[model samples]
Target: MTHFVTKRAPAVALLIALLLLPACAGQEAAQPTIAPTTGAAAATAADTVADAATVATPLPATVPAATPLPTATLAPDPATVEAAASPAAPTAAATRTGANYVLSLPREAAVPADWLMNPPPDFQTRSPGPGDTYRFACLELPARSTGLATVGYRSLEGLPSVAIEYAVYPSATEAGAALADMRQAASDCIEFTIGEGDNAIQAAFAPLDFPAHGDDSFAMALTTSGPTTGDLLTHVIKIQRGHVVIGISHAAAASGPLPDTALTESLAQLAVEQIDALTGE
Candidate 1:
């Protein structure tokens, strides 16, 4: 989880707090890597029981609540990676109107000064969307030619969050075997625990029946919390040409039935749609 920004209500206070954190200063992607943002904060990230799948009103056409993505600082040095990964990708600055957002595509070669720099070095290029602003996920995954990275994120206001990673290798066999280490990490470092989820790591990856979205190839497991309280929320997205991974997390002040699923799914789809809209040229 790159950095944690705690939005106040709609996604400002905590979002700014996340942007102000020392851990997130300057971001870079001078080479092919899994530099994820975790973006800024905006929605109320507290956890609450959802009212079941209620028909959601599509986000306003005018994206209203996105934070200013920092500039990309494609630098090297593992220690400096955070500085390079904290900013946005190469593209035009996105706009907002109540929560809606949009961003430009990478194929244009015309990137905005404020948008995070992309094509970090060895990584391939892909457009985000044809617009100026868009929602996205910023993630930090294992750094290897091949391996599985346990990923999951949710946005504020109880939106749905989806996390899946892809690290290609020489062959499918190599890729499959290479992920063993990652499995160990997931086994050793990550664990699942139902109820209000808020810990150093997600107690469990929810959505028990997690489906492989379109080309999503791996057999995934899912889980969800009953409810809880939170005071902060973080918006983040990670994009790398062929594959784009996005997710979010909330830091509640209390524990109970709070609404956060809405924010999670909203952010997830926002970032995913941007990827789908992108041109992998």
Candidate 2:
């Protein structure tokens, strides 16, 4: 009876051990599987944690609104705009004083030695006003001028003379307009008479082609006939430079030949010198 009991006990122990092995395996399979956190997986996990943290945090009671930046825009240059707006401004030569543009006696060496600056007392004062009867009115300073300087040369023999008139205006446009008016006056006074009786003289005008100078220039010839004065001829040349205008005239007895080329060339050179002085060149 003792031997039988021992054998039964061994069989029961074996069965118990088999049942415990299966239970332990099942428990391990039911537990969750853990993966290694690395690479993209690690980054994803960090981002998820940050998102949860942000959701958990509370913002201020009044959150400020974002402001948008202004759009870029192009603008025109200021100098270009100013130049376009102010067209009346004169050239660089216009900076000179009125006297600096006039020819001085020292520089008149090109003129004949016998000729002298003996302008009549009323020469410059001869500028015509309303109802004025001045004989050389058209040759005087134009109206609306700001300043003037005049010099006249007369031959000791009293047959030929030279006169130079310089004037400045408010602007180059005004100077140009004045030049045009002088041209019109010369045209209108072509056949006019000066004085009366024996002293009376009949004058005729004709255009003369002269070399261009300064910004603009024109020349005309005037022939006058009188009983005492005989026949006399005058050549007038007008020029515009910046805001300044110049009129140069050479008058002589019509009996003599036209002024020599030397005289006319010298006068043109004088004009150029005056312009150069104004321009500071």
Candidate 3:
């Protein structure tokens, strides 16, 4: 069975304290490569999890609620990859609206026939806040008065797994600025440490140039691995259209360490068109 990691209410304080420690300076980002596997994808990761080592160290308490994230020594060129041109008009359905936002899924998103899209239970009621931990999630946007919604997909063929989040901000200006902030965050938080003891995982991200289907977009690949689990690579694509931002995070056992560029591009195209249609852009 394939396993997916769902978001857990993080110990916000602990994560903040850990992210403040000097990041591993000058650690070269790992090139995308197929990790060695001893068995089926799920089983190999499960075995690795079982072999984790525990150490004695008292957990810290009274840590500060906020800390500065270490900025990258050099910022990456955001336009490194020329974005694919925008797609034609979308045939997607009606837009879904919240108190202050509107959203729509790509009608041609290329979702497999059998894949189930399980949107979050609280998607309609949730609102955003300015928290540093959001940056750790890789493709997050930096905006005030935002709303977040996510949908998970499951399938039995091809790249069987994927998840997408739409974060809606109040205005196009804020959304564009937030997109730039996230791109910089991606560079600054290029690498950071998460967890401790046997569960410690070294995490790093590399910027990518994907077709910007909206007013602007940013893409990257993130890898987090440790002694306890097989290395996991997530290809994240973030698109900003006016006041809305769409973030896609996809991974598949069949695709090896990184997601196929063409596949992610198609997904982005679908989203960009639908978003454009939503706001009559």
Candidate 4:
């Protein structure tokens, strides 16, 4: 953050010099005096004339320097600065502090201390999927009217990580319909594939029972195996609240099928409460 500072002029210094000038002028005008009319006096008078000629002369009046007014400086807006720095890559701090796009969503303070929010794009291990391709580029969410905001948290002690993404549509109806389509896609997207040829990764998703919130909701557990990580599981809960669609993804090594843990359920419940508080419902 940059601080605003004002530059000041030397007006007081000038004023002090002006006040002391009169006494100095009197000393400059002093001249030696001598009595005349005698021979001895003539020599003294000649000396006085020489002394008077040596007396210093007074200088001309100087113009007072003009004093400038303090200039006002404005600090840069935090959002504008972050946008300029990296629109595609936002920090966890920025995600929580600068994400005012959704007024009714969870604030940064609501996030758990054990979780690290908004990992940088480079820090993420997963590649974009087919569903991700339709993000802001498709008919479901028109380019200008759609918005995406995400907050990610990784366990400070382990490999478990969770991310909450909000996708905003033009209206509640559009958002609701899109979420319905997503639930159907999630149901049918079992045993899917990513990458190409030998580098391909096999993935699967199974529906899970979760307490409903918002206008509509669905839960799923996704299992994927890759060349490097062996196998991993992600528990996902999708919720549609008004014109916004919220997707929370919780991932860890597939120790079984990513059963709904207390941490996962608590995080989801917190999001639901934050959404409700935000909408004043």
Candidate 5:
């Protein structure tokens, strides 16, 4: 099971403490009260009872006033009780569509200044089209996803392009299953083709070790080479936070320098922050 850290309001904390105080005190008060029967104290108690039975005690001419009992603790306020019983409310981002979570141009520091939003032909599509030959699970949307939003960014200076895909599932279990499928598929399918005929491109997949984030995460690298499209490498990272999943990919020509480590780390951090924001963490 996945666990998320949440901060509780001071009022809620005080209410909880009030409710639990009595239960804890009751448990302590309920400890065994009967004394050991084999000890000298037991004999003394028995002797006192026998003596009281044989001798009658005389009542006082005037009875003294009865001793008063201590008052009970006050009950918690009704509003405080109600608030403590209810679950935490979700944030605005959680109710909105997947597009709200995707990274944008100048708004996000992770995105390069020169990068421009340039979605591919199959953007926002739930499944791949007939001509699409990319068999990697990371490249395709899971069958159980209810919503999808994709945004791609290309650098005018010929730097690595970035693609962010956000998907929402019915539950966290389904999202986790989808992430597991992608990890398994990447491990099993080492090589694949992107197209058919003379224009077909050969690609190889290798797992990429990345810093852990969110509830679950996995990273992989795909290298492709073809007569039409020279050598190229794409680094993809998928993160599952509750019922939402986000995919981030960086693609560049293999001949050029690899994507900067600091850039990808910043992107990953941004994704985590967005997820936290959505859940009101």
Candidate 6:
């Protein structure tokens, strides 16, 4: 905001004085008068000396000029800057922005704005069962190969929350229509008792725990929450030959039905939408 600046110039001041020296020498040599005009010379001596004194005052050896120094600027640190400045930092962003390990999302990617980590470690495609709470996890795959995504959620300490996870398998590795399996294990496993364990769950439906809705490659599992207060159950799903199998044991606890079923459905809807938006890139 200041209008004027301070100046300092040790070098420029000295240069100006040097340039003036030749001019001053020519002026004095041409103007000096000698003895033939003694009276006039005597009178002009005072004038010449006075003029010389004025000129000499401006060119002292130790006199300093004032000039401002240029300000120095520092560069920004790369480590402090964000490595991946993308909507989503993952395989998709990696291809576009070329970040070594940064995961990026599409500009149009739909981020779950309301997702909660309600069940804590309670939910996973794979985990041991706990009785009081209900949890679920699944992996969504792309229509084509070379896709990758991760479970997106921070943490949970609420009545309802949802998490969506996606997987990207390289198409080059697996042939056309290749598949993989997802698993869930618990304290004790209910080995398929064939038709026997089927109806055994009929008695436990609304009376015991809430109902669950989950899907695998081909099979869909719909089960009522179980009776025990702290019963644990695991769901194991597998993918193969354009089909998937889903299995569940009656180990879910008897809370008046955990709010997990509804949450899972909402997450499914979100994950599908986000995946579609991502794959378009």
Best by lDDT: 5
Name the better of 1 and 2 by TM-score: 2
Tell how far residue 53 is off in model 3, in angstroms. 53
Error of 2 at 73 (Å): 59
Q: What is the per-residue lDDT of model 1 for residues 144-245, given as tens digits with 9 covering 90 to 100?
A: 232112222333332222223323333434334333333333334334432223422223322222223323322212222222213322222222323322
Candidate 2 structure quality by residue, lDDT tens digits, 133-244: 2123234333545555555555554435665666566678977887776677677766776545764657677988788877887778877665544566677777877766
Clash list (residue pairs), candidate 4: none
lDDT per residue for candidate 6 within 134-192, as digits (tens), equals 11222222233232222222112111112222333333233123233122311112232
Indicate the worst ten consecutive residues by lDDT in candidate 3: 5-14
TM-score of each model, paired residue for residue: 0.29, 0.55, 0.57, 0.53, 0.59, 0.29
lDDT of 3 by residue, 65-145 (tens): 898898768765556433444444443234445522323654324676665443221243334444522434434433243
lDDT of 2: 0.52
Alpha-carbon lDDT, every model: 0.29, 0.52, 0.52, 0.49, 0.54, 0.25
Worst 10 residues of 2 by lDDT: 17-26
lDDT tens per residue, model 5, 1-281: 00110011111111111111111111121111222223112111111112245667999999989899999999899999999998756466546654454432113345777665444212232432333222243244235555555545556533366656666666789789878867777777687765568856576789887888789998888776655445667777788888777777777657677866677768777766766666664
Full candidate order by lDDT, most accurate first: 5, 2, 3, 4, 1, 6
- Each prediction's Cα RMSD? 21.0, 52.5, 22.2, 33.8, 29.7, 38.2
Q: On a 0 to 100 scale, what is the lDDT of residue 250 in model 4?
A: 70
Best by TM-score: 5
Per residue, candidate 4 scores C-alpha lDDT tens digits across 26-90 of: 12211222112232111111111122456578876996788999999999999999889963432
- The better candidate by lDDT, 2 or 5, is 5
